[model samples]
Target: MNKPDPIPARLAALKTTPTPDLKQQWRDLFDSEPPPFNRRYLESRLAYRIQELAYGGLKPETIRRLERLGEELDGGDRSKRSVRLDRDRPITGTRLLREWQGVEQIVTVTADGFEWQGRPYKSLSAIARAITGTRWNGWVFFGLKNHRGRT
Candidate 1:
């Protein structure tokens, strides 16, 4: 099941604001120089901060649980970083599947990149966008990242 966003309407409205306005909004909310990220990133982080201030941040227990999960996912050495995982970290030899436009899509993981329909892709996001005709975080589209935890 998916958890509902705490401030859906406000988040939805943020998408329409101008870029300059978004930068100002980020400064207003975070009280610091905003990271040089795109509008989508800015809006998403600002929305999170807004909700965090209003309804309180994530519960301590939830944070601990996520931390433990992260360690487990990283093979118990959380400090050791995998250079290949700087972005999407699909396990090699794993098969990724998705359904788009009522069709099942298949992708195979390789050491260098993801393979889709005999073609090699640099990133899963590229494959996902190719399949869907829209920008998508390949991990999220392939169910590797849960929808409920997006915000």
Candidate 2:
């Protein structure tokens, strides 16, 4: 008789496994302490580890390809990897609404920039400056990003 695969059973069991047991499994499989993450994280990582050991991990070529893609996205700067440019801009045709000093303001996103007050603006900061007569981060003014630049 042919041997049945255990990976499916192992993965399913992870959903119900206790957190302490999952940590122990992590220690056994990874030979290190589990991260201080939640139980769901532990379970997910443990499941991946189980399948990785059973069916092998990513191929060397695949890893190299992923690294190359990362380098292209970050311009070879590892620190820049955490910053994603695509997310900085709102989708084209999106309309953003805000109020400043009790006055309603509306801005429409474009393919390359934004339009506000019946005027085309290359940047949100410029629109904010025109509206408030002072410098302001357009993203913050538009509420697309927080003061810390996070979306």
Candidate 3:
């Protein structure tokens, strides 16, 4: 039988086999040229990832960071961190019986009173009782109200 080609020569040739350029392969996979490495882009991408994680049910700290990122993107001024709550003034009376629109349990305060659409109560607990037909949870009603006190 003919002697096999030298193993060393075969191994050397195999080693020299043209290797596909990874960069070009990646560009082809993406169907576009790769974007230049940018610190700002990386940061924004990271921020978006963090926001998704937070909204997907991460811890409060993570949500806070995501919110900060959103505020930064919106050009929000962070120096003014104080929220003024005029608790000394009473709720006085109801303004208009509006309704809660969004999924989040939000109580919108107008010039008159609070209005929640999805909420069980109409005029607070009385409405709540009228709906649920029992005491149920009065605190839920009160909590939705803008009482005269510091929040």
Best by lDDT: 2
Could you give candidate 2's per-residue lDDT for residues 1-151 as a string of tens digits? Answer: 9899989998999987866788899999999987654565578788888889998999999999999999988799897656443366777898877656756688899998999978899999999899899998777777666545665
Alpha carbon lDDT at 9, candidate 3: 54
**TM-score ranking of the models:** 2, 1, 3
Residue 19 of model 2, lDDT score: 69
lDDT tens digits, residue span 80-114, model 1: 55443435466799877665655668889999988
C-alpha RMSD of candidate 1: 10.2
Among these predicted structures, which one has the highest TM-score? 2
- As for candidate 2, its clashing pairs are none
For candidate 3, report its TM-score.
0.22
Task: For each candidate in the order shown, give its overall lDDT on alpha carbons.
Answer: 0.76, 0.80, 0.41
lDDT-better candidate, 1 vs 3: 1
TM-score of candidate 1 relative to the true fold:
0.48
Candidate 2, residue 62: lDDT: 100
Residue pairs in candidate 1 whose N, alpha carbon or C atoms collide under 3 angstroms: none
- Model 2 lDDT, residue 131, Cα: 88
lDDT (10s digit) by residue, model 3, range 26-82: 344445643332222323333444344444546799889988996887667654433
Please give the distance, in angstroms, between residue 26's alpha carbon in candidate 3 and its true position after superposition.
Answer: 37
